[model samples]
Target chain A: MTLKEIKELLQAEVICGDHHLGTEIILAGGSDLMSDVLAFGKPGLLLLTGLTNLQSVRTADIIEAKAIIYVRGKKPDDQTIKLAAEKNIPLLSTPLMMYEACGLLYQAGIPGVSPANNSNKAND
Target chain B: MTRDDEFRQTFKIKGRDFSHAGGVSTEIKEILQEIGIPTQLIRRVAIASYEAEMNVVMYAQQGKLILSINPETIQIEVEDKGQGIKDIELAMQEGYSTATEEMREMGFGAGMGLPNIKKNSHVFLITSTPGVGTYLKMIFYLDHEKAS
Candidate 1:
């Protein structure tokens, strides 16, 4: 699905990068934990997170996430918004909680970045 | 490229600086992008570098991140002055963490930093002194066939 469809389905507000709404988003992962996102996120993955901090934007950029959808009506500060804009990673705000957001996306045929059968164990 | 043909840069990280955390890693990513590093390799380097930088901001007084790159490899070295890890083996575990509430509030402190770094790098090394500091060196080979 495209980010435009997600925005309409979730009734989300585009906090930044409105120009990027046309971008395609096929995979997503929802988490408040940045480390887990780092571990499991794939390039171009859409990140659905409740954490509204600079690190969220940074994590999205590091993992090459296509965009970030902030759940639970949370929004980041000005610095975080500035960073997101600088990185060209779009930011969207939604009133729904994390679980609901994930469900809606999943129902639309978007899959999680990590497969359910895979273990989270660190191989090191 | 030969050792003589390399790009090197150093960035300083200040502990407890939540406002500016992850900035260095962003710059490093931009540098690597400008140098034409592969997107997949850049993502790996960015993930490992950001994790290392976050550790310094969360636990150290101050630290330095050195990025040295050549045609064959990308290397990152982080040395910090602060309370170091007492048990390296335990710290490398997936769920082990000593992060504070503030760190968690930022969506970190899940105890996956070191292992995540190791998972992304071809070579990972960590050394620390409980009272003194910690040091990390991670290398990623540009050619997967040569990495072993």
Candidate 2:
């Protein structure tokens, strides 16, 4: 699904990367643990998380995640916003809880980035 | 440093700061990439170095991560005189960890740190003295040195 559709599905406001709304995303993962996500994530995946911290953006940058969705309307602090802007990690804040947000995305044909198939893909 | 023969850089890890835990590894990864190291090897070294350094911060009580960067290889040596590990054999097992709740809350208490270091290093060694300290050495080669 396109990032634009994901933004609408979760009722999320695009904090950055508005021009890249047409970017396609296939797999998604939801977790608040930055280390867990870092330990088991593929590049270009979408991360749905409730944790609003600098480390969250840092984790996304380390893994090169496509986007970070802040579930439950938990907007990050200003410093984090600046970091996200710098990293170009397209941030989205949503009112839906983690499970519901993931489910909606899954039903909309956006699948989880399962580890079995998480072998690295070209960033192209 | 994952290049085959470029240059060398060294870093001294400070074990007290939790916020600065991954600093050395990040620097190493950046240097390796800029030195024309392959992404795969760089990632492996980064993971190993980061995990080893975190272990020192969380468990060793205090230590330093000495990173040696050369054109042909990357070596990470963790040396400390802190409370040494009591059981090396048991510690190497997956799912075994001594990390406290605070460390877990930071998202790294999953007991994968040691296993992670061993898995990524082309050469690994650990030595410890109960009353003295612990030392870990790891090496990852960037070149096909066997042919040389």
Candidate 3:
């Protein structure tokens, strides 16, 4: 689904990259761990997390994630938002907790980053 | 600049600097993207470099990251001064991390750093002493046809 649709469905606030709302996001992965995100996240994936730090933005940029949704009403600091803008990664925040936000997206057809096959491939 | 040309840069990473961890890798990723590296290759480079940088920040006093870009390859050499891994083999194992609680809180120290770096690089090499330091070298081959 497009980022615009996800934002509207979740009632998320656009924190950065307002111009990219129309971009399509293929996969959604929710995690609080940056390592897991780097190990499993695919390019153009949508990242949902509660961690509000500069590293979150850096992780999304490293994995080339299309956008980040900050769950549980979490918001990034100024440096984090600035970095997101610089990297062209769209940021959004929703009042829903991580579990609820992820469920809403998954129920809406957004697939989570599975591990059975993904883990082996990542280690290989 | 075409494939035949080459460029190189060295970036310094200070240890225990959580505030700016992964900054070097981000810069390298941007440089690779600007140079028209394929998305797949750039992702690999970015992941490998970021992992390496984080290692230095978490475990070392400081480190130097050298990025060498040539027509045929992109190579990163990370050398750090700090507590080095005694058992490189054990360190390579997934889920064998010695990261502290603080590190885990930052969403790292899951013992996947070295393995993930190896998985992302075409060539990965690591050497370390118990107390001296660690040295890592990673290379990614560039496909000329894939170059934009």
Best by TM-score: 1
Ranking of predictions according to lDDT: 1, 3, 2
Question: What does the TM-score come to for chain B in model 3?
Answer: 0.93
A1-124 per-residue lDDT for model 2 (tens digits): 8999999988999876687788889778898765567566667789999877666776676666889999998888887788778768888989999999999987886666554544423222
TM-score of 3: 0.90
Model 1: how far is B46 from its true place, Å? 0.6
Regions more than 4 Å wrong, model 3: A115-124, B1-6, B143-148
Clash pairs detected, candidate 1 = none
| B1-148 per-residue lDDT for model 3 (tens digits) | 4344768799999999998999999899889989898898999999999999999999999999999998789999999999999999999999999999999888889999999999998889998988999999998889745433
Q: What TM-score is obtained for chain B in each of the predicted models?
A: 0.96, 0.85, 0.93
Error in Å for residue B134 of model 1: 0.3
TM-score of each: 0.95, 0.79, 0.90
Candidate 2 Cα deviation (angstroms), residue B131: 6.0
Pairs that collide in candidate 2 are B3-B71, B4-B71, B4-B72, B5-B71, B6-B71
TM-score of chain A of each: 0.92, 0.89, 0.91
The CA lDDT of each predicted structure is: 0.92, 0.76, 0.90
Q: Single out the weakest 10-residue window by summed lDDT for candidate 1 chain A.
A: A115-124
lDDT of 1 by residue, B1-148 (tens): 3368888888999999988899999999999899798898899999999999999999999999999998888999999999999999999999899999989998889999999999999999999999899999999999989776
State the lDDT of candidate 1 residue by residue for A72-117, as single tens digits: 9999999999999999999999999999999998888787766562
Candidate number of the best lDDT: 1
Retained native contacts per candidate, as fractions?
A: 0.98, 0.10, 0.66
